[model samples]
Target: MKTLHFALPFVLIAVGCDMSPDYKQPELPVPSEWNTADDAERDSSHISAIGWKEFFTSPELQAVIDAALDNNRDLRIAVLNVEAARALYRIEKADQLLQIDAAANSSHQHLTEAEGAGPDGRTANHYQANLASTAFELDLFGRVHNESEAALETFFATEAARDAAQVTLIAETVNAYLQWLVDRETLDLLQRSLASREKSLELVTARQEIGLSSKLDLASAQAAVESVKVSRAIYSRFVEEDRNALALLIGKHDESLLPAEASLENTTILEDLPIALPSNVLLKRPDVREAEHQLKSANANIGAARAAFFPRITLTGSVGFASNDLGDLFTTEAAGAWSFIPQISIPIFDNGRNAANLDYSEVRKNIAVARYEKAIQNGFREVNNSLAARRLIREQLDAQRRLASAREEAYTLAHARYEAGLDSLLESLIAQDDMLAAQQAEIDALRQELSNTVTLYKVLGGGVLR
Candidate 1:
């Protein structure tokens, strides 16, 4: 007992020696600055610092996003995963400490005469009560310590994963909502176009009956009306499909949550993202952070694997009182008893099992490193692509609007000429077709431009503040 007391300090001192390698964050593998053509004089505040509600200013969209955050199944599962990882980390940390338990037992044994008992038979009873710690390992080589560290890193990784799920969910919900609005707007446009084409067909039929227009003109007007009907049908299906998709994202079918009327132009989404921000901001992205945590966990696992090559020391002990009679077990007259069992296990040979484990840990760490780098690379590419899309889509939308305006003017002039008998009816019909196509293209371009902005915000990790 005295020897144990004297060696306790030395054991504690030895525990300070950790075999784990010092951790250092890897260098960024991307460029320092964005390569976009946009003005570099944007807001310097990080996108992640901007809350989702602040960015998505539409009340209807905010409500839908709030519902999704509360009820999304994938996000719920991510939260549960974080909790499970936290519990497992606590269990691993507890293994580094002594676990004491109280126990009491009584036993009776009978000896027969054939077993050399005196007279007929003999009976003996024993009782004991104790507080014992079973197989408490002393972390002389930091194996248990590194295991705890690995578990802690794993917990962090799970938490980051949950955040990543949340960011993705918000982005998806916003995209879905925008798509629904776009489809509705397109459907409205198609319906109006169909009505106009039908009216034109009616006019052509009346003129043909009066011998003022040819059969070809009447047939052309009919074909145009049918084409508009086909487009309207397609957009009608699109609107319903968009609603179904949005319902699944928001986790409910509450029609009141959606806007009564909305347009891509009127949907309020902030565009204050700093396009000139350094690429290092990718580190703040939840998926990238999750990958880094995983890499850190793998690094900690290598430390545990290295420690497995050293000696392990365990202690099992109990302090108790024992007596032949149960009534006397807790009395002063009972025999006082204690035990100290210290064991040391040296790794003499293991047929290369430990070596194989060390190799496996190293390989896993390498894989984690690769994944971390890949995550950063993917983030860089996404940001660049979004930036490019934002600029190009804006230009495209401008060009489409101009084209629509020109086609509208051309259609008006062609109609006037046909009414005055200066041009054929077919020329006016062609101009009308061009005007409709241009208007549809303009609407599509506007939708694409707005959708691109939402995507840019998401890829820049802008939704995590909420």
Candidate 2:
């Protein structure tokens, strides 16, 4: 035992070298900055540095996002996934250390007279107690170390996935809320149009009875009122459906928190969101970071696979006391014993199993590298698309607003001309139709502008760092 103890330190020193291959981060092909017509001035603060509560200034919308984060089942599952990966990492780390157990046992056996060699048969009794570590691998080739590292990387990847889920949730919630408000405003606009059309119908009817307007004019006015009614019905349906969508996003059926009578003009979402350099996306985006961690884990797996081709050594030892009498189990009369077992397993012949494992690990690493690069590429594309929209959408919204205002003025003049007997009822109806369509377009454009901003905020990896 003493000789073995003296040689243990030398044995560890001799076999301390790890057979695992050295790890290097995979190279990714990426551009330094986004390809925009004009470089956007860099913001002093990053978008991700802002929390959802701060970015979305609406108290009501912020409450909805917070509720979704808390109650959404998918977010709950993501959090649980992170916890499971963390527990798995802890288990793997624990496996790298020695496991010792204390044990006590008593045994009794009856022997026949021929076997006992006494005048009569007798029962034999035994008692034992010990501390033991069984088959603890030495990790000389770094197989265990690599596996633990892979587990740790996997845990980090899951954490990133959870963050990605959170960012998506917040964006979806905000978009749904904005859409609800826009639909409500559209419905309100249509109802007001309906009231004006009803008054026009009454005016035309009165003129026709007094022989000032023809039957054709009265019929046109009635058709205009019905058209406004149809539009109002459609918009009312949209408002209700938007409410339903918001409920689903918040993972609850509560209606009290719905955005009440809000309009595109009054709801507060920032028109200007800070843009980041394309290269920084890899660091800010959680999904991209998650993919990178997955790639790293695959790289560590390759090391574990390589180490499998080498010999594995294990050690099991026990030190204890034993006595036939229970009372003397811990006394000086008790027998003291100890054991040391050193085992080596070398792969002499395998039908290419180890080689196949190494090949599989390498293939996995290749797949992970491709996925990592693809994630970065996709992230860059999203940011570019958002930036492009950010550049042009404001112009589109401005044009839509001006068109709506001009159409409203044209409708007013047309109605006045018809009333003063200078224009046909058909002309007034046409102008009114154009005005309604223009108003609807303006509302839609406003919603689009808001949705694009939200998309940019999300694609740029906002709402994660906080």
Candidate 3:
């Protein structure tokens, strides 16, 4: 027994060599810095770490995102997926430990005289009880360990996916709310334009009757009124549609909880997000993190596959009491029974299945590596595109606002001149048309800028609600 005990340690030590390859993170082809404005300083602290509540200043907007986090169906599914993956990982990890069970059995048998039980047929009864461990494979080459590691990585990947879903939900909710505000603003402008155009048509018709304006000028005035009416109807529809989208994102159609007619001018989200290094995006973005976890999982799979080519060892054991009488089964008079089995399976010959598995694992790892790199590349592209838009959109929005102001002034002056008999009705109508278009353009630009801001937030892995 002493020698047996001494030799068991050596056996375990000999089989402790891991066949699983070491995990080396795949090198990414990422730039050191982003192509941002020269004045923009690099921020080591990624903006993604900011909480959603802290990033969004509007109480109404924050409430909307909170509702979505609680009620969004897709986000709920993502959370459930993480739970399932965690459970699967636990199951896989449990395989590396012993599994013991308590067992009890009774048997009856008839022995014939030819079986040498007795001259005549006799009945025999037996009873036994024991604790036994079923066949448990020893992780000599780390097959079980690698498999567990893969499962753990898979769990981590699902968690990252959940975070990615959360980011999307927040971005969508904020964008929809902001868009609703823009549509409301445009609708108000169109209504005011419609009223002005109606008054102009009345003035032009009165002048035509008095021989001060031509029928053509009157017709132009009428067309402008009808055009503003059409624009009003379109924008009103946009407002309603935007409301419906927001309701869906929040996972309920509670109109009372939805944001009331809030003006875009009053709405304020964070204007500047910290700009981290391009490579940091991989760590900040959940999708990129998810891809890295998948790569690690594939790497672990290769280890498991490699281990499959080596000999597998398993052990089964039981210790029990046995007796012909059921009452005596647990007594000292009962016979002590025990069993121990150590199994070894050395791969002799197979139809190239093991080699094929190894090949498949290698290819899968390659696919994972490619995917990981692609994720980084995609993240970099999104951040760069958003940065480019961020730099140019502010300029565009400012120019549009200035043009709208100029057009408004021109329309006011032209209208007063037409009423004072110093200008033609055609001139006033043209100025009014230009002003309406310019105002609408300004609103559109504002909406684009707001949408771009949400995109930047999402691409930068803006924080999820805790």
Best by lDDT: 3
Q: Write the per-residue lDDT of candidate 2 for residues 112-203, one digit (tens) a residue.
A: 88996487888888999999999999898889988999999999999999999999988988888888877787888888888888988998
Across 53-87, the per-residue lDDT of candidate 1 in tens digits comes to 88889888888899999888889999999999999
At residue 383, give the lDDT of candidate 3: 87
Cα-lDDT of candidate 1:
0.86
Listed in order, each prediction's TM-score against the native is 0.93, 0.93, 0.93
Q: Give the residue spans of candidate 3 off by over 4 A.
A: 1-10, 110-123
Cα RMSDs, all models: 2.4, 2.5, 2.4
- Give the per-residue Cα lDDT of candidate 1 at 232: 85
- Pairs of residues at least 3 apart in sequence or in different chains that clash in candidate 2: none
Overall local distance difference test of candidate 3: 0.87
Off by over 4 Å in 1: 1-12, 37-39, 42-44, 111-123
